[model samples]
Target: MDRKSVVNQILSLLVSAAILAAGTFVFLTLIRKPEQEASANPKPKPPVVRTVPVLEHDGRLDIVVDGIVTPYREIEVAAEVAGKVVYKNEACNGGRFVTKGTLLIRIDPRDYELQAKRLTSQLEQAGANLNELDVEVKNTEELIKLAKDQLDIERKEVNRLAGLIQERIVTDSAMDKAKQAELTSRNSLVRLQNELQLMKTRKTRLRSAKELVATDLELAELSVARTEITAAVDGVVVQDLAEQDSYVQKGSPLFTLEDTSAVEVKCRLRMEELHWLWRQAGSQRSAQAVAADYQIPQTPVTVTYELTGQDGVRYEWQGVLSRYDGLGLDEVTRTVPCRVVVPDPRAVNLVGADAIARPSGAPPALVRGMFVSIQLHIDQPDPLFLVPEPAVQPGKAVWVVRDGVLALVKPLTLIELIERQTEAGDLESHWLVESKTSALTPGDRVVVPPFGVLSAGMAVEEDGTP
Candidate 1:
C-alpha cells in the first residue's frame, strides 16, 4: 500500500512543476516582446514651434528723437554805469514783449547831471583864465618893445657921451654914469622878455586845462545817457534783477531777455542714426564735402508736443535743421546733439496800427523748456524684410519655417536695428534684413517661440494652421 501511494504523489508533483515552469516562460516572453517591437519600429518626434510670416515692404522711415525746446537767442542786459535805479518798464518784470530801443530801466540822473554841469563850469572858468592870460601876454609883449626902445635910446646917449669925453667935451665920470644907465636899461629889457615868455607858457597851460575839462564834460554827459537803459532787441523779458530803488554796480546784470520770435530744439541722435543721416546727405553731397563738416542737412522736421494744458492732443510744428548744438558725445548715452529751428512761433500777423491777427486754432507758443519729439523724414525708398529678434540666430542668420520645416539663412545685407514698442508698452527690437536668396521671400513663415537648439533641415510641425 505504501509503494503505490508514493508513486502517484511523485507523478502529480512532476505535472505541477511542468505547468508552473511553462507559465513563467510565457510571462517572460510577453515582457520582452514589447521591447523588441519598440526597438524595431520607433515613433518619430516632431519639433513643435509657433511661426510668423516675414514682412517685406518699402516704407518711409521717420527718424524720431527726443528733445527740449529752447530760446533761439538769450541776452543778459547789464548796467554800464553805477547808479540807483529809479524806473523800469512794465515788461521788465517778465513775460512781456518790448520793441527795440524801448526804455527798460532808468537810473537816477541827478548826480550825473550835476557832475556834467560842474565840468562845464570848470571848462568855462578855464576858458576865461585862458583869455585873461592872452591879454596879459599881449600887454607884456608891448612893454618889452617899449623897454627895448628905451634901452636903444640909453645906448645912443652913452655912445655920444663917450665920444664927447674923447673929444675933451665931457669928463670921464659923466661918461661912466651914462654907460651905467645904458646897462640898467639893457637889464630892464631882458626882464620884460622873460615876463612875456612866462605869460605865453601860462596861456598854454590854461588851454590844456580847458581841453581836459571838456573831455570830462563829455564823459559826464555819456554817463547821463547810460542811466536810461533801453531794450537792445525786440524780445520778451524772462528775468529782471533791477527794480525801483535798486542800486546796481557797473557791469551788473539787470535783466535776462530771450528773443521769442524763433525757437530751437536741442535733440540727441544715436551714432547709428547719425551715420544713416550723414550717409544720406553724403549721397547728395560728395564724401569729401560731408566729411569736412558733418552739419546736419537743412531738412524739414516735424516736431510734436503735448502741453500740460492741451491734454492728449498733440501739437505739431514745422522746423528746419539748423546746426549741431552739443559739444561732444554725451557721457551716458553716447549721442550727439542737433538743433532744429522753428521761426515765427508766435504767428502774429499785423493787420494795422494797434491791430493784430493770429492764425486760427494755432498751437501754443513753443516756449523754452518744452519737451518734444522730432520726426525727420528720410527719402530712402527701398524694400526691406523685417524679422523678429527672437527668430534671428547667430551669424546674422534666422530660423525660417519653409513647408513646415526649419531652414537657416544668412541674409545678404542687414540694414538696421529697428526698435519699436508693443501695445503693452514693451519695447521690441527687430532686425531689418535683406535676403537676395530665393529660398526666403515675403509670406515665408519663421519660427518664433519655443525656439531652442535647432539646425538647418530639421523637421518641425507648425503648431497652428499657419
Candidate 2:
C-alpha cells in the first residue's frame, strides 16, 4: 500500500515540476528581448556639466577699503599773553573760516600800553641823564686843561723863587710862599682829573641803564601786540573758548582750528592686500627706501565719498598712500592701518554717469569724521587667472574639463579671493589663482556646480557645448 501511495505522490510532484518549468520559460522569453536590446547599445551618454572659461585678468587690481576722513593738521589756538577779552571778532566763532593772520580777538591792551609808556619814560630819563653826564665830562676836561696850565705857571714861579733863595736875593718866607702856591696848583689839577674819571664811570653806568630801559620797552610793546590774537593758519574754527569780557590767563585755550589745506583718510587693509602693494613697489624701490624699511609705496589712491540719498553719485578726491598708520597689524582686526592724504580736499570730482552739474554752492569739503571709500590702484608684476569662486574645489583644487574629460587639479596657488562689481552693479566673488604644475590656461574650461558625481578621467560634456 505504501509503495502505491509513494508512486502516486512522485507522479504528482513530477507534473507540478513540469508546470513550473513551462512558466519559467515563458517569463525568460518575455524579458530576453529588452535585455538583448539594452546589450546592443552598451555605452551610455556622458553626463552634462556646467563649466566656465577662465579669463586672464588685467595686471591692475583695485583694492577697496573703508576709511575715515581726518584733518591734516589741527591747531589749538591758545592765549600767548594774559588779558581780559575786550573784543572778540565774529570770525572767532565756531565753524567760521579765517585766513592766516586774520585778527580773531582783542585783549585789554590798555595795561600793556601803560607799561610800554612807563618804559618809554624811563628810557627818556636815562637818555637825559646820559647827556648830562657827557656835558659834565666835557666841562671837567676843560677844567683839567686850565689847571695844567696853572700848575705849569706855578712850577716856573717856584723855580724863580728857588733861584732867588739860592742867590740870597729874596727872603726865605717869599720862597716858602711860592712853594706852597705851586703845591696847591698841583693838588687842584689832580682833583680835576679824579673828577673827570668819576664822570666817565657814571656815563658808562647811565648808558647801560638806558639800554635796559629800551629792552623793557620792546618787551612791553610785544606783549601789547600779542594781546590781539590772530589766526596762524588758514582754517576753520572747530571750537570757540574765548568770549568778550572773559578773562584768560596765559596759555589758556582760545579756540581750535582745523587746517583746510588738506585732509587724510585713515583706512585698514588685510595682509593679502598689502602683499599686492608690496609687489607693485618692488620694482621701483630705491635703496634709500629699502634702507629705511619704507614698505608701503606712495601708491595713488582714489578717495570716494558717496553722497547721501544719491545712489551711485560719489565725490572723488585723488590721494596718495602717505604712510602706515600704526606700527603693526591692528589687534582686533588683524589688518594693517594706513593713511591716504589728499593734498587738496576741495578739489572734488563728481564721478557718476548721471552726476548733475556742480551746484552754485560748492560741495562739502573733506572734513574730519567723514567715512569714505578708498580704492588703491595696484599693478601686479605677474599674470593671474580669474575663476569663479565656486569653481575652486576643496584643497585649492579645480575640476577642469580637458578633451571632454573631467580632470581634478589640486594644489593650485590661490593668490587672493576678491569681490568685484560687475557692470550691472552686482558683486561677484572671484578667485585669483595660479597654476604651478598643471596646464591651466586662460581659456581652459573649469567645471562648476549643478553637475553629477565627478571622478578623475570621467567623460563629461559641457552643458553649453554643442
Candidate 3:
C-alpha cells in the first residue's frame, strides 16, 4: 500500500483512544463520589428529655422508720446454790417444761444430811436445857415469897424486943441478944432471896439462848433443802446446765426459761404515732392499739405488725400496748417512736408478701439494722406536687425553661415518697404551692428537643421553632 494511506489510519486510532480516556475520567470523579456520600451519611434520632408537672400541698411531713421486735421478760436463770449437778429432767436445754416446784437438779445430799442431823441433835439438847431452866425459874419465885414472909416476921420480933428493953422488963443483954438474933435472921432471909433472884435471871438468859439455837437449826434445814434444785417458773428450757456430775458455781447460768404460749414484739413509732397513742390513753379507751405498749410511747425504734390487709392480705392481730420507752423527737429523721405489737409470727398465722414494708418514698425493701437509708414522707395534702424521680437530680436540682432558655436550680422544698398517705393529722392540708420554676420563670417556652450541647443557662429556641 502507499505510505500516505498508512499514516491516515494511525491518526484515526489516536483520536479514538483520547475520547475513551476522557469519558472514563469524568464518570469515576463525579458519579461514584456522589453515590458513595449518599450511601455513608445518615440522619440522627431526636434526643429524649424527661420532664414532670409541678405539684403543691399544705405540706405536713411524714417519715419512715425502721424497727424490730423482741420477746418480753427474757431471763437467763443461773444456779443460786453451788453444788455438784447430779440429776436433771430432759426438759433441760430446749423444749424443757416444768411446773413451779418441779425438781430440776439434785446435788449429792449425803453431806448436807449429816449437817442437818447434827443440827437436829443440838436443837434437842438446847430445848431440854430451856425446859430445865423454866422449872428453875418457878422454884426461884416460890423461894422469894418465903424469904419475904420470914423477913416480915423477924422485923416484928425485933420491934417487940426493943420495947421490952425500954420498959426494963427484961435484962439488957437478953433484949440485945433477941434484937441481934432478929437482925441476923433478916440478913439470912435477904441473902436467900438474892440467890433466888440470881437463879431466875440466869434461867431467862438460858431460855433466850435456846431460842437462838432453834433459829439456827431452821436456817440449817433451809440450806439443806436448797441443795435440791427446783424450777421456780413454768416454761420451756431454752438452755440447760444441770447435768450428771457437773460442778456448777453459785449464780452460774443453768437454764433459759421461755413462755411461748403468748409472745410480743417491740417496735417504735414516729412523733405522729405518739400523738395518736396519747389521745387514746386520755380518752380512757380500752381499745388496744394494734400493737400497743402504753408505757413507752415514744422512741426512735419501732416494733410493729400490720393488723389488716385487703384481698387475702392477712391483718395483724390487735394487742394492748405493753410498754413504752417514752416520747421524744429524733434529730436524724424527726420521726417519733411508734411501736405496734402483735402476736408473735411463730404464734399466729401470716398473710402475704404485700405486707412487707419500705420507708416513705424509699423504693428499696427494708433490711433490718441498715444505715443511711431514706425515711422521709410527704404528708397528705390537696394538689400534691408529685413528679417522677428522673426529673430531679441529686441535691434536689431540676431544669427550668424560660423565654426559650434552659436553666438549672435547686428546689427550696422537695418531698419524695414511694407511698404517700393522707391521715387526719397529716402535713398536707387543703392549701398547696405548686411550681416548676427551678432556674427559669413563667412565660418561657422551652425547647422540647435540645440541639447540640446542653448547658445551664444556655439559650434555646422557643417551642423549638426558629
**Residue lDDT tens for model 3, 1-466:** 8999899999888888888889899978887898889889886543334333344434444444444544444458776567788787665656656776777777666666777788788778878877877777677677768767876777787788778778888787876777777787777778777877787777678777777777777776776787777766655676675677898887887777765434444345555555534543454535564434536433222222343224433423334344544566567867554333433433333346554653243222221222211122333322345443444555765565554457766662443343434445343322121353344333323333234556786654333332
What's the distance in Å from true for residue 356, model 3?
Answer: 22
Model 2 TM: 0.74
The Cα error of candidate 1 at residue 319, in Å, is 4.8
Q: What tens digits encode model 1's per-residue C-alpha lDDT throughout 73-104?
A: 99998998998999987878888888888998
Q: For candidate 3, what's the RMSD?
A: 14.1
Task: Compare the candidates by lDDT and give the number of the best one.
Answer: 2
lDDT for 395 (candidate 1): 76
Candidate 1 local lDDT, residue 102 = 92
Poorly placed runs, candidate 3 (over 4 Å): 1-67, 95-99, 279-315, 326-466
lDDT per residue, candidate 2, 1-466, as tens digits? 6899999999999999999999999999989988898889878899989898888877567778999998899999898889899899999999999999998999999999999999999999999999888888899999999999999999999899888888899999998888899899999999999999998888888899899999999999999999988898899999999889999999999999999999999999899888878777786677675724655778899999876667767888999998998689988989999999999998888877666887544367888898988988887766778888998888888898999998988878777678867778899889877544455887889988867779999998888731
TM-scores, in order shown? 0.57, 0.74, 0.54
Q: Which is superior by lDDT, 2 or 3?
A: 2
